[model samples]
Target: MAESADASGGGENKSVHVCVAFNVSNSKMPAFCEAACKLLAHAKADKGCRRFDFQREVNWLRSVSNEEHSLFMVRQGWDTADAVEAHVKSPHAQRFDGTLVSESMLVCAPSLSLFGSAMTTSDLAAIAAEARATQGSEAAEPAGTSSRPVSAARSNGSRPSS
Candidate 1:
């Protein structure tokens, strides 16, 4: 999964995080990646964008029938929720949406989520607690049996053993 975090200090400043995952058929993977790269470039150039990243999931068990297509993740951070809204309304985003709707692209519907800080202190505390609990569970798992899935590639061009 692609992950990005943006933090801004000041009582008036708030950060927004957006994450999206897409599945593209093997035949259309190349075109999808090319288009996605262009879209990301445009987003990164936007004044509102603070951070942007893309990642392709590597399926070690490709011989199995679990997945027929490749998964791509897009992670982004914006200065505020309004910035994210403006990005969605941008021309580049409109064109990218059109690409997603094209039949020849062979891309499945994407899963998307947007996150922003909670208004109340109690709500923020609850969210933080839940995140910590999730992390603890993953740390408790045996090596190779982690609840959190790991990407296939390492920075050094090596794959972790399954």
Candidate 2:
């Protein structure tokens, strides 16, 4: 991936890091995950998207194991604010506006924040590099219980190591 900031100047307000938390109702788990996966897949291809990933919280107890909630981090390199607005308006996002949620479902806007020096392209790369370096050989392990090793090149290029 190319590391270039869309910022016109060295101004501090160039880009933003958006972390959205979804408090999904327990009953809405499947639909939310499906729609979320579709949105992330599309957003990953968006021009303004520097990096994007979704994280699900671990449920220690079986009682809360089914609790549905997640965090989506979309790092908008230079056009953070505008990109977020456009994301909400984009077809990939609008599709889930109403259809993804049932009457009992609830939703909330992501708490937006700016990451001055931290929002730069270099910062993102360093973070990714650190993760990849930590994972090392473990990242090559087979998916699930299969002993088959994942393709070395494919795993390296897929995304920053978990």
Candidate 3:
């Protein structure tokens, strides 16, 4: 499993959905599926686990670089990033990785993406402001730029000449 983002902040609970895609050796897919079952079962019992599922790619044979291999996806949702991190570090998940992922069974490291995280505009603005301060002169906008509405200069929808 890939690392979970540090999404905890502002005393607000933010749910996260994690998706991991795997392409594995076709001959080893059965073994991968069997191990994932135990991992999912253990993770489902974890605190703040909202959903967990492991699915096979029915169209895998058409897309896989080698017809002998297959694809799969793991979709999970949790009440917090902490839950996802804990699940990743859990012994069952570790065992699953040890059993299949650490070896040559997988075509590549699993691809992971996390969604549904919420952040305040103010929090984002603060980060932008800090970056601007540290960036010094490079942060300045080009002289031709203006803060005015574009229509003020080009109401006829004609392109400005260079």
Task: State TM-scores per candidate.
Answer: 0.60, 0.49, 0.62
Q: What's the distance in Å from true for residue 115, model 3? A: 1.3
Q: Give lDDT tens digits, candidate 1, residues 32-68.
A: 8778888988999887799889877765754211345
RMSD of each: 10.8, 15.3, 12.3
Q: For candidate 2, report its TM-score.
A: 0.49
In every candidate, how many clashes are there? 0, 0, 0
lDDT for 13 in candidate 3 is 49
lDDT tens per residue, model 2, 1-162: 012322322345556455554555566767777887788798878767776777655645432123344433434443555665677688987876565544334334444444433445776677678768757655666648445455654432211223
Model 2, position 99, has a per-residue lDDT of 54
Clashes of 2: 0
* Model 1 Cα RMSD, 1 decimal: 10.8
Order of models, best TM-score first: 3, 1, 2
Residue pairs clashing in model 2 are none
